[model samples]
Target: MLKMELFGESLKQIGCFQFSGVPCSYLAPMINYAINTNSFIMSNNEGDAVAIASGISLANYKKSFGVVLMQNSGLSNALSPLTSLNYTFEIPILGFVSLRGERDDMGNNTDEPQHELLGIITDKLLRTCDIAYDFLDSDFNEAEQQLQVAYDYLAKGKSYFFIVKNNTFEKCALNHDKNIFFEKKINTLQVKDSNSNFLPKRIEVLQHLSYFSKMNEIALFATTGKTGRELYEVEDLDNQLYMVGSMGCVSSLALGVTLQTSKKVIAIDGDSALLMRLGALSTNAYYASLHNKGNFCHILLDNESHDSTGGQFNLSPNVNFAEVAYFCGYEKVFIISSFEELEQALCFFKNRNTGGAILIYVKILKGSKEKLGRPKVTPKQVASRMANFLSKD
Candidate 1:
């Protein structure tokens, strides 16, 4: 049994007495402690936990901290809010992640195949999200210090996490307010009024890219949501990086691979997700400048809406993506509105070596893939395969 008194005291010291997220058997001790002594809220899912935390932070105008307790498998489900809301709005959260079956000293492996991936790739997921976190141990004093550091990061508008292994904390009382109140406020206003026919087609751009490049030579990283689904439906997505979750991060992931691998890494990112983490472009540019790797190409499909979520307007202004790329230190930036222009841009990007990132902005129509199926591989599996692939000659 794990004791939460130390962790609770640390939370109290940081003034982050509020908690959120779903329950996990591994987190029962901490959950029970929180319910017994702190203000905690239980959400429907991990994503909802993040959303509610975001709301609380925005409403209170204080550094709000929420402990999202969920099984490692629920990480994918929580990524949308993690990458989008947290990354975009710079909402800080302290995730109390329960690592259920990660002990090496265990006699028999009770973990499922799904959990294996989660356990292996949890750090990678946090890294891609640009979140810094630490693993929790039984040492109450050390855990308290770590929690304090997490609180400080949260104060600075960055998400931090504390990964807890199974049975790490001692059992405690459950005395939380049953009614964890959250206001239900919805924004129903449409930001854009024009039903413009000027937007281009996603299929046209995909077709052009497929035609221009040899499929084997070009590795595509598709962002989560409609852009990924569309690419999966259009191309032979055998080993292509089809992001299951973690929206607004395909470009960053592409940059990571482009830095290490010799293959051309192309990221098919959506406008909404791109806008969510626009700072990623600057980060990518900084790294590209440092490493001088110029094989990264980010194809931004600007549909001006969150097409995956019922076509809600993302308020993405009609800004020149080329200009944005140039400002971010991209060596070559191309804003294409037609198939021919995209083809020419691709050719130029393939040959350019100015030691920077490239942004190819394609104006696309907003549409959802009604029949797009989920990818077979998990994020952990993909990470493993990619690591192995990079390690090879």
Candidate 2:
């Protein structure tokens, strides 16, 4: 209850009545409170939340602010916008991340292996981005003051963050509009060309992406999944952007980078990750309508399983992703089930209008790479490199 009161007071004090970001069990109490108060904007991913906040700040113009909440691991997904777009373009964002493995944090035994590094590096990652942040462990007044400091930074064209340990906040009144929380629909589209039934192996898709990489006009970003690992192994590690953590957000990050630079951006993502955060497609459509960045291409590789997590099955119903893209507002949507068709789609996307985004769906087989290597560089390094790359003429 003390934590809830402190969080409420902090939100009111900093003028951050609006909140966004994907849900995490670690921050359930805070998320529940935000929803209860009708101040939460529940976005598709951390990156989408940051982009939305950026848009809100740009449109409102009177020091508008929003809160992005996520697990520490999701920080990798949100770093692109945090560094390249927000830092470079001077868009202020405030993040409230839930720390998963504090000395007294709950659910430590049940946590995933991937979250271990995130638990240790959260603070270091923030500092690397040049963001001034504070850890809210138990002191209510200290948390409030930190929020104020964060607000000040946001007002001055910089991002601020406050990391709270898990379960620090107690349950409060559920005062949010229930209508705002809606279940996302699964979108699966059948390929129009059934004759081209030859799907490419992961190696083949990687080779084709390599061709795109050679062009110098395109930059590739991979999400956290088999697709990302395969791309990492097959592509030049130094030349491409690989998200070691932060599932379901490569597309949004690429969109932010594309918005900032003229170079075409490609995101290699997976079906499970896409299912985890489908709301990003709608956000992409919305942003495309406003900014019209023609250089963003989202390549969704559908394997129908969480291959990185013990090949768990995703029971998403067959829905049309291309139609979903169209509904979300992308002018160019191509769904291909075969390698040849994918190649054709890629060629078509390359020549399409530079005003809207393009989505190309590539269906692939699901399996783990036995000896896939992890990323050597930290998330901050990847972010800084992306910022530097996008800033160059």
Candidate 3:
């Protein structure tokens, strides 16, 4: 088997230093190597890992690469962002998916029964997602060549994956010791039930947030759906990335951007989108504290309905988002329903300097202005410009 250093060093030579993913036994060696030598964000799930990698790739301006590692079963968890976020945005990431039930020379399946079906369909699934992949070579020199080929594809803004079999890399010990502890504080501002309907509309909140972004010179990631479309209508700036299809990934992607840049990064999220991946809140909070990213702001526009999909009622009303954020490890949490509270919250965020991410849960009504329009700027252009914006000193 090739030493893990050979693979890791080769990836470094090819400009890939950022890595994230869920744990897999076959991938443990490479994961250990990355943990010891590079920046690896152990994501809460595979999809978030892909989206975080996308954020790193986008912010790096193609000068560096992000790698994703997961088991074949977890590939299903990664499929959404891999297709919707990476493919749609042309964000390239090097993915290594472990082959759990690979066939041997005699063509017999050689893995656990649990992996049978997924193993049978893994390659087909990759093809269906339009991801080109190669079997990781057992030879060190050949694998180094494979890394260069992967870089070639990544340079073209196309993701290249590697299907890794068992024992592909020599065992490597995790030498890094990491410790992160943050107090969970729940701070809430009570709003009267009578004032619920009178709360700010989604567009008004966007207008305020858009203004705050412009005034602070921050990068904003608007979640998929009306939040992004509305932000596009509010103001389409080079520093704003309007997520088109990767629902529930805005915060995790913002976390990636926060790790890559010192600029304040704000993510505008929706109730439905946040619910799609509730685990992201915990992931974002954890990394924010671990990395000491005080500039990350997670704003959830809770309307209790999916306004973009005909205003269907959702479960947001039953849940206390501020408490969730608090328990999830956000250093600061604010619940605001009116413009006055929002303004105060923004001022506090701007003035504050040291803490983890700040979560602003804004309760709003579920309605948009008549004839709301989508962004005229293409997703690739958005990604490119945001990369350039982040690259600036």
Candidate 4:
């Protein structure tokens, strides 16, 4: 039997302890072990895991390799960030992928019809993503050899993968009954008095954020599309991180940043963007409650349309964001549809978030200024700047 603790210890010895992933039956015991005894995060999905890993790795730059573990069936989910975010930015991650239906000695020939095709093409997919891979063995010595290969690739600013057979990790059962606790708190949400013209456009909100960030020691993470472009226009301060491509991941990235920094981390998001990664709302809320130091804030701009994507309809007209944040466990929820409300909410969270995590819903107009430009810098540049800023404090 492979000792899960030994492998985890080896990973720590080499300074690669940040682990994030979804659970798979093949690696349940290992995941359980991680939950019990490591700085592990239950990333909402495979791709979220990749992004969170990237954030953690970037936070611990020069001293960490973010490890992502998932099943072969979910590799497709991870392909986006693995290629665009991690590979493009030269972020390294050691992946442990379960071979759900391999044809070799560890093959599950009769496992499931769905796992068969995914297993057959797992290595092909990895190769297509320009990721190098090696199969994992039960022996710790063999695993260390594979880790050495991954470490070598990481040293050169690249990613690597490990394909593992089922049952490679010994059983580590979850005692969820004793380890779990849930408490639902009922609190009324507050709204500020503000003007509701929706005239200034989302750009105005970005401008407000720019001014606010300049005055306060804050870290700002913008969502993809116009929100990012508009923030770029406002001014790309070292503290401002514009998420260019990942639509719904801004909050997740901000959450990861909050875990590493004491700065007031805020995710400036859009309506469509928030809808795309609704799970992030819950994830951030959960973590904020656990780490309830008021280190995180979520500012969502609801224009009622996907203005960045040709103004497509995003969500129902009646969706109450304040209620969503309230139920999601935000320490304070503000439903601000006007400039006054927006300003007041900003002031409330400015000096200190005495209440807890905050969500500010800013309803704005649909159109932006003519000839709005994109980020002049590359993603790696933006990521590196943000990473460097976060590392300092």
Candidate 5:
């Protein structure tokens, strides 16, 4: 069996870093190794993990593979990116899945009843993804060979999988000495008043972002639903990555991109999406502080409701996202209610020289253009173009 460090070192040899996944007991040892000595993120869900991996791979320019790990039960959650992302863009990922309910000699289920149906279909599901898989077990040479095969597939622009039965890796303990989140000066919001009737619309906000994104060469990652659609309607830029279907992973995707590029990464997020994956905020905060490059922005276009999926309400009215981001280690917090304040905030971001993260809380009204449209390009095209742009800049 491979020790945790050996496994991690082997992965480094293949040019892979930036691990993102949900916590599963079968993955704890390997994850602990990452937590202690490597780049790791505890993502909000399996789908978010996949999107983060996708972001890393898109920014990698065929040089590295990002790893995403999750339990087999979470396969359904990950399917969104597994299909729409890797399959669509030919972006490769070293995905690890925990096979929870593998039956033994007596044929009794090894895990809870909830896993039985999924366990039966796990391999078939991988087959459906057209992804090749190998079991991770007690042989170092054999497992390394399997990884080599996975690398071969990745070189050809495809994802590969590792299935762990139960208890595969040696324990890698988390050392408390490491600072997961670096200390930064506590941030406070400077509020300015605006006319309630003159509050800007969503499309107007997206237009401002689009212009700035192109002007500043900032990589823009928009949340799924109307946010992406509206951004597309405003203008399609090579630097933009539109979230197709992953609802809650906009910031996670932004984090991965921020890690790989010096250009500022801006996530145009929605209230519902943010609420779904609140953990991603802390993940972004921790990594943003560690990878402080003076260029990361998080904009919450909160309409106080799920404006995309009909006027369904979310918790943003009761929850203060600007305050939340401030506590989450964002260096600059801007909670404003008008276009003038937003302009001030963007100017603040443009002029800041050192490490900084900003959250713009604009009290926006709900409405969109009558003829909203999606991005005309494919996800692969979008990713490749962004990769090329990032490489050049």
Candidate 6:
């Protein structure tokens, strides 16, 4: 068995500090160490972990890095962002995925029934994702060599994985609380005039929000579909990234970027996309509450329909997004239906420097401009420029 310190000290030696992901038994020792050192962000799920880690990688490149941990079963949850976000953007992250079900000498599965299929196919899945991997070594020098190889891959902007077998690390006790909690005075605002029949269109809100991209103090992220396309049409700036895929990961990516840099991150998300990864709301609030240097603003454009894919109705009309965010631990919540209220919310974000997660639920109308064109730049180009902008001191 390998002492956790042998691996942990090597990671620190290579300038990797940020860690995020869900818990896995095989990774508990490392997770406990990360939590004890106050360097880990507990993610809601595997996909969010990948997106969050990608954000950290993008913010500063090789100078800093993030490691994502998960069980092999969680690979299904992580597949989306691993392929769409990380692969498309060419972002690198080191990961530990535990092997729960492995065949013995007689070729018999040794884990529960649920892990059977995934374990049998884990190697193939990683290969399909274009991720290279190596089995973690138990010896000190061998483990250090493996980590250096992983770091070499990361330095070239390529992701690498360690397939952790059972009992890879010696047992380590957790001295810190695993539960995430933050007690702060949260501000709630309901900005519906009740008499005004005016509801902002998607473009109108995007136009107003594009002003933030004009300045470098804020890093703007537009969600997939019409939201990103509309923002691209308004203006593509060095401070903004138009998310092409990974439908619901924009907010989690924003959280990752927020944690890495002092620049405030604003995620302009759609109702459908937000609903796809609802658990991220709590994760954002939880991390923001603890990491006081980072500020994350989540703006949900509730148009009640999927304007990009089709005019199908979504669940947003039935959901109270602002109240849900408040209950989920957002430091501030704003429910607005008119442009005036949106203006007020923007001012609130601009003037306040208090670090925590903030939510703005804006009611918007559907439909886009005639023949709205897609972004001219590729996703890699967009990610590269944003990374450059964030890296500037």
Candidate 6 per-residue lDDT over residues 34-100, each given as its tens digit: 8877888889899999899888888977776788999999998999999988889888899999998
The collision pairs in model 6 are none
Name model 2 segments beyond 4 Å from true. Answer: 1-47, 51-93, 96-159, 162-196, 237-239
Question: How high is the lDDT of residue 169 in model 5?
Answer: 82
Ten consecutive residues with minimal summed lDDT in candidate 4?
A: 178-187
Per-residue lDDT tens digits for candidate 3, residues 346-389, read: 88877766568788887787798889888888888888888888
Clashing pairs in 5: none
> Which scores greater on lDDT, model 1 or model 2?
2
lDDT of 4 at 321: 78
Candidate 3: count the clashes: 0
Question: Which residue pairs does candidate 3 place in steric collision?
Answer: none
What local distance difference test score does each model get? 0.64, 0.67, 0.85, 0.78, 0.81, 0.85
What does candidate 4's lDDT look like per residue over 252-295, in tens digits? 77776677667788889888877776777666777676665678
Superior candidate under lDDT, 3 versus 5: 3
Order of quality (TM-score): 6, 3, 4, 5, 2, 1
The residue-level lDDT of candidate 4 at 47 comes to: 80
Best by TM-score: 6
Give TM-scores for every candidate, taking all chains together and pairing residue i with residue i. 0.51, 0.58, 0.94, 0.91, 0.91, 0.96
- Selected candidate, larger TM-score, 4 vs 5: 4
Higher-lDDT candidate of 1 and 4: 4
The residue pairs found clashing in candidate 2 are: 35-176, 36-175, 36-176, 187-319, 188-319, 188-320, 294-354
Residue 276: error of model 5 in Å? Answer: 2.1
